[model samples]
Target: MTAVRNVHERVIDAPAAAVGALLDRLSAADDPIFPTPAWPRMRLDRPLAVGADGGHGRIRYHVTAYEPGSRVRFDTPPGGGLDGYHELTVAPLGAERCRVRHVLECEVRGAGILQWGLVIRHLHDTMIEEIFDNIERAAAGGVARPVRWSPWVRLLHRLTWARPRAVGTPAEARLIRSSVDRPDYVDAYRVDLLPGLPRDPAAWTGVLRDAFPVLARDDGELLMDVNTAGLTARASILVDDRHVTLSTAVKTDSPRARAYWGVVKLVHPVMARTMLRRAHRALALAAPSAGERAQAQSPAPERS
Candidate 1:
């Protein structure tokens, strides 16, 4: 077994109380840190107190200890080759300065070591630095030089980004469903509409691009005319509270259109899924960070 201990620390030009207040909101709906969108947001089944259960992404851990405005710790369940705890701590450096630190200690054997050294380590380091960046931005006003993702980190992010899954055309997509009677081709792809992503169907029209004219819009769906290549077609982008779906319907008017669609149908699913997934990720990355959103929504100070 190999033991691993990794640490990251940053000094913020803000009072310990201020920085720690941000720490206390770790898994909050409006968390002021944790560097989300670019990465998975930390989540807890309940509030961020001792016994809270949840972790970001695939990691599974539960809160082991909590100290309101000073520190918090989480421990993974036992038995895995990688077993241990990770925690965040804040200490006052002076009247207007504080040090924020994160530490991960674990015991790894066999494949765990390779996974840690080759992949997890790089991702962890990048994520930690980004967290510190958000700390400085939120608590101390701004980061002089925000951390930049390395090529390896960027590659990993792309490879791990969530992809859309195939789904039947939603009945709610009335525009597309009724646009093509006896359609020659139809398909749909869906992905979660994660928090912080846009809900406006207009914003999602990029899935079919501007070339497609807006045919109609319902309460939550945008229908666009995608007629081209001698085929009559329509595309629908549906945005609801829980999911976003992209659906397409095509009608072949003649033998040429049918033959052309036969060849296009082979790659249509892949293309539709790819476009939807790309749009999902693009919107996520463009959204304001959780910290920024929290700060924006914070109440303004009273003028005495």
Candidate 2:
């Protein structure tokens, strides 16, 4: 059967060896990009080696080929309706420059098409660009440049998935307002609760703690750390069966830090909304049953 393929390529200022080394390190458990708050977290079961098993989140794969400081590929199984391979390669340009390329080739059918068509394709493109930007930045002594979505992309996202709310501070239980004058980025999404699910704040919090590692959920405050941008920001996370809101405040004292964060902030809406949406799904799955809710709300039995 013929396979589908996707390729991403970018030139970096660093030497081939440096780029290769960084990519090698990234191929292992600790990826500089995989921890992106906007995307799902990835964990490798072990270090990169031919025939080793791992992939992002639930996408399992085994390494098919490996070459130190050059290229590597992983092959996923066929049963998931996606039997394909992804590869990373680096090539030198003189002593101080190189090209980095990532390729995906696989046959996807059934459920895989839905997953890829709906979510993974867009996120993968955006992230691959950011990874290119990151490698360039790292090679150039850590100068910062972040990926920004085009208006068309943002518009499509809004039209397809997220709804627009008026720009202002929201009333409690209302949608999040990300409006800010100086540093611009805003995104919010709201969806109705699924049938048979009731808003249970306690159960929602439990699901969040287990599924997401980005937001530090606490009684009165929330915090997020996007180390790549050197941002330590405060966010508000509130949940109920009826509505869920994720909000954050942005301010910086240092001029350099402000400038850096300003660039990264453009993608915050996509990042923020994506994360909260996942939380919403997890909360739905973990929603307590009717019987359990009734038990909790019921009054204690009176003494005989």
Candidate 3:
């Protein structure tokens, strides 16, 4: 069996202590935004100790080792979708800098292999990027840019997860701040509205609505809810005085549900950008400038 290994190291603005503080504060019941976002929230079944069993949703894992602020590792129980371990660590670089590194070493066999191939890989990559994004934002104490997925990457995602899942609505899905907005979403994709387009978010809604099935359009924002390929997620249209941002936050009710959403997430960025550009061009055509309108209205020359 091939073991999939994910190793990532990132430099953060804060010192090791600051990073450690962030890690230490997470309770067993809380989902640490570091490793994975499959679970909306996690609860510690017992105190942090080796051999303790704790995991969220349909997944279960045991703590193999623990080192406050510096290192921690969790291993999945046999037969879980994941059959290995993942570890996280933070180390100081200097008085004002530090590095957070994480590694996942696991192999999925049997039915789990399909989920890993179609969803987990994409979702895992996305969530790790978010961890870096959030850490940068938190350390910087303000808005930080999120990961930008490429068109080719997004295309592969769509091709793999074209079919919809069979699950129904999650037990609950609260409209909350997204990953770019908050950590509620493990995988979030964003596309900036055209620079020349109108500043008001509502101005972009009509064109977007024509392209995507807009769920709700109100004062300053719009919502697009989707359920495709066994995944359920929502994307919103938000704007400031100068620009609009289109973002999606998946709502996964369970591990399997999350897997479904994860597969599509790989392609979400391209989808968002594609939709934005299509709508933008349509808007321009529908409301041509005065000069263009005049040219169109002018009488045609004799004989074609």
Candidate 4:
């Protein structure tokens, strides 16, 4: 068995009260810290309190202790090859300055040791620093320099990025479904619509670019014309509450078109899935940070 104890701390040019307020909002629906969109948002089964059970991504833990504006700790469930807890705390450094710190102490055995040294450590460090950056930006006004993901971290993120899954043509994609009667080819791919991603169908036009003209738009679906090589085709992008689907339908009216499609169909699915996955990641990266979203939503101070 190997024991690991990691600590990261940052001093912010803001009052401890201000910094602690940010900590108290962790796991909130409008969480302004903990770095997200780039990483998974922390979640809890209930509100931030004792017994709250949840964690970000594959990591699982539950709240063991909570002090409204000063500290919170989460302990991992037993028998996961990991034992111990992680916590965040805030302390006053001066009248107008404060320090925020995160500590993770755990014992790992077998494969858990190797995983912690190689993967979990790197990711946890980056996440903690990013969380501090958000604290500075939200409570201290701005961060002169923000943490950047190292090449190794970037590679790991890519390796772990979510991919699109093959799915049957959704019945909700009425535009594409009804566009072609007895269509010669059809395929669909879907990816979960992560929080903060745009729900507007127009924002997903990149899924079928190359100047595909929009033929129609339903509530959450955008239908586009993708005809070429004497073929008739329509693509639909559907953005529902839980998912985003990209569906394609094609009609080959002649022998030339049929032959062309036979060769294209083999590669079409691959391309469609790639495009959807790319767009999903791109939108996620471009989405506003939680702090930025909170600031934007905050009402302006009333004037005399």
For this target, which candidate reaches the highest lDDT against the unseen true structure? 4
Per-residue lDDT tens digits for candidate 3, residues 148-241, read 6556446543443212122222212123232224323533223333223365655766534445566765555666665455455666665544
Sequence-dependent TM-score of model 3: 0.46
**Cα miss at 161, model 1 (Å)?**
1.1
Clashing pairs in 3: 28-44, 29-42, 29-43, 163-229, 164-229, 164-230, 165-229, 165-230, 178-182
- Writing each residue's lDDT as its tens digit, candidate 4 over 188-229 gives 999887668899999999876698899999989999999999
- Model 2 bad stretches (over 4 Å): 27-30, 33-35, 142-145, 150-304
Q: Model 4, stretches more than 4 Å misplaced? A: 299-304
lDDT of 2: 0.55
- Could you tell me the C-alpha RMSD of candidate 1 in Å? 2.9
2 versus 3: better TM-score goes to: 2
The number of clashing residue pairs in model 2 is 1
**TM-score result, candidate 1:** 0.87
Better of 2 and 4 by lDDT: 4
Candidate 4: pairs in clash: none
RMSD of each: 2.9, 21.0, 18.9, 3.0
Count clashing residue pairs in model 3: 9
Q: Write the per-residue lDDT of candidate 2 for residues 1-304, one digit (tens) a residue.
A: 4367899997777688876765676544334423232333344567767877766545677888889788888888878666888788889989877988989888877776876776667766775776676565445434255568766545444444423132233344221223222433333344344433434433434323334334444442233432334444444445444444555555554677679877777876666656665565554435532222222344223322
lDDT of 1 by residue, 153-224 (tens): 888887788889889999888888988989978888998876677889999887765577898898899988
Clashing pairs in 2: 199-241
Residue 19 displacement (Å), model 1: 2.1
Error of 1 at 142 (Å): 1.2
Task: Give the higher-TM-score candidate: 1 or 2.
Answer: 1
